[model samples]
Target: MNDSGAVLPWLVIRQDDNGNRYRVGRYATRAEAQKMADSLDARGHKQLYWVERIGQSVQ
Candidate 1:
């Protein structure tokens, strides 16, 4: 499953440190997305963000 957003909903998570940490995942709800990201046990510089389709993808 791609888990890509269909409606283009999103949640943005950010980390500080050379600006090199981020992740994206599709979610039915913002709460669900936040839970999923929290479940990752992010440490050091691992930031998870639930961002929907803002632009367009070729593939």
Candidate 2:
């Protein structure tokens, strides 16, 4: 949650190769999330997906 009462969404990255997912970190902006994903991709983790967190959302 931020200064507003609404729940803030998260930017998540998952490793597609092994069906394992990990939270790179939480961000209030999509750009921050993309940046993190790109950083991971540059590090050779190409099999990754970026997703947003929604209300009552399930992985």
Cα deviation at 29, candidate 1, in Å, is 0.4
TM-score of each: 0.41, 0.60
Q: After TM-score superposition, what is the CA distance of residue 45 in candidate 2 from its true location, in Å?
A: 2.9
Each model's backbone clash number: 1, 0
Q: Please, what are the lDDT tens digits per residue for candidate 1 over residues 1-59? A: 23553563544444435665444555556677677666654543444333333342222
Candidate 2: clashing residue pairs, number: 0
Runs of candidate 1 exceeding 4 Å displacement: 1-5, 11-16, 42-59
The per-residue C-alpha lDDT of model 2 at residue 6 equals 53
Q: What lDDT does the true structure give each of the candidates?
A: 0.49, 0.67
Task: Tell how far residue 46 is off in model 1, in angstroms.
Answer: 5.5
